[model samples]
Target: MSDTTTTSLLDAITVPAAEGRAIPDAATGETMGHAPVHDVEHLNRAVAAARAAQPAWAALGHAERSAILHRTADEIDAHAEELARIIAQEQGKPLNGPGARFEAGGCAAWIRNAADTALDPEVVFEAPGTRSELHYGPLGVVGAIGPWNWPAMIAIWQIAPALRMGNTVVSKPSEYTPLSVLAVAELMNRHLPEGVLTVVSGGRDVGEGIAAHPDIDKVMFTGSTKTGRAIVKSSAGNLARLTLEMGGNDPGIILPGTDVKAIAENLFWGVFINTGQTCAALKRLYVHDSQYEEVVRTLADMAASMPMGPGLDESSVLGPLSTKQQFDIVSSLVEDARSRGARIVTGGEAAPELGPHFYRATVVADIDDGARLVDEEQFGPAIPVIRYTDVDDAVARANASDQGLGASVWGSDVAEAVAVAQRIEAGTVWINQHGTLNPDVPFGGVKGSGYGMEFGREGLKAVSAPKVITV
Candidate 1:
């Protein structure tokens, strides 16, 4: 514990990291990308090791386990920049994306929230002959299915809470972005119990295996709604616990009287940051008639001006779309939108010259409500603007999708904006800013956007189970 680098702590464990090996590029095949390379077989072995080591880990007193969690938080902070770089490489996000900050911050937040905030069992009611109490307990092993867009950050999103509650984890990082997690898992194997947490790397089959495994007590997933449904149906057989943050067609409503330019910047960040790969990215925009043209024009100009290149490059404001599958999805969505009569005011195609998978930041305007681009979770670097006559109508249209994940309201009048925001069916509603996340606030979705919270006190409780005892 005295060694700040976690050096002595790591020295206590038996598993050594894969040494002197070259790392692979998550987005491309040419470079070390970011972190040390690992093998899929190695990841599988580590998780099995964790499963074996979990009973002892679970047997630790809550206080003892909590102290160790704090140590892990410190280790995360010490490696923030390095991990951020790895995340950028592995997830194909811009180095400036909140990955590094989110990784370190989320770990500390989850540890504190889970360990300090979760309720303890106490005698609540007693019969004349009996004493009754209720408390939370850890599930044996958690199977976490994380998306590539947020490899490191999302892993911590699940790991911190699960570990704090004394549950082991067998996390499946995106095949495209596994190293950042491998790094974390390696650190864990060295510092914590060998099987307290592990990473299992493969494709969707690995996900299926974890979901169907009898030993996995719960399944927490962050990805598309279609996949979420499959996970739900498959997991129902075992009556496993489920936490999902699925597809989001989040809407951003620009109400009248807002400074058109300022709100436009917020919209740009909402949709374009992380190259529009976030689950909460503003996929749909509803601007009041008074500000429709201005909002569209301003958003188009800003989006068009964004620099697209490699994320590790200093000048790049946007990076490649992570994997070739994402690149194709973005490209196809853009094409489908244009073919269905959406106006391509800014970017609408892949820029092959940028790299193997770089796509321009796209802003599609004049798209109707029925257009696939306007109503679906694009999950790409594109936002389609739709105009509405009334503020009520804007809210109505924004709420018109099956997915309700995150949304934002922009207006000079905070009271009116709040009233309008209250009507939208989403897990989080921002008054002005969009796509912002905080550790204290809960984040998740409603409807097909999936269920359960991932942060704050609600999140702390969700990853654990309550047990009642009567004597």
Candidate 2:
């Protein structure tokens, strides 16, 4: 639990490999470390090892597993800053703000939630001669495929619940940010029994293998919709129970008469947190005609004032895009919106002086629903503000999207905001806030955003198998 212990833990996993894929620092294009490039065969062995170890883990029962997870949470707290450093270097989220440190803390908080959540057998029915009780048991081994945006936190979201519900886990971290996940798993393995958890740091092949492997009873994935579709296909071979949390183009509606200044900072952070690489970040905004100009101007000023630089910089609130592919996508979408004559309120260019993957925090106004930046999930520090006069039309436009992960409504009237939030077609809706998550709240998506819930007691259920006992 000391600094030296944390350093040794990281060193054990980050030892230079003779032949492994080079991982680059997101802030600078310099090579930071290497991750072992595992293949399908490696995935097979991991799954097999997990399968071999699952029965004994399940035998430990919920109380015992929960106790272990509680200790793991302690370990996470001890190594939080170290984990944050790794996340900052590998994933390009700044140490400050809702970036690396926040993510590292989130991992521990979620684990504690999973451990504390009680899932005792429930008595559903009682008759004159019979009674029915519902119980949740382990599904053996769960394959967790995580994303680059929140490598360590999301991996914990998948792993913690599965472990609490008595299932072993084989996790496949995103290729873009493997070391953070590996480092986290290394700490977790300290408390976990051998083969109970594995981090297979590999590419698409490993992900595909995890989905299709017959031994993996369930697969929990968080990433793009396109990739979610492919996982569905791969999982079909084995009919693996899947929980996919995919892409989201979340919309935020600012009601007329709302105070723009009061909500500006929250709105700005909602859109630009982690440099806006979040799955449920506010991607588009629909402002009532009366407040559109003020909202746009206020957000632009806030975005301009915040520093955007390397993740290691103490003053930086925003960092570069995590990968070149993501950087290109954001650039292309913003360009497409610009070509369509949308007014660039602020930050319309990349910060090449900062880093190769650094795109400036951008806000485009006078844009309609059809603009590529407004329609597609840009997944970067770019937001499009669209003007609308009718509240009904605004609700309709927000609900029209194929993706429905999370949405927010802002207004002075709390009742009115809640009413508007109810109509938004998203898994979770917020009033005067956006993208704020609690470990106790159930989070997931509908439509193309993917199915299955995570967090709270429901999240514990998602990774578990239900059984009915009637007598």
lDDT of 1 by residue, 108-194 (tens): 565556556545677888989999887777877888988877777778888878887778988888767767776666544546776
TM-score of each: 0.88, 0.98
Clashes of 1: 1
- Candidate 1 to truth, TM: 0.88
lDDT of 2: 0.91
Which candidate has the top score in lDDT?
A: 2
Tens digits of per-residue lDDT, candidate 2, 178-236, equal: 99999899888888999999999888989988888888899999999999999999999
Model 1 residue 44 CA deviation (Å) reads 8.1
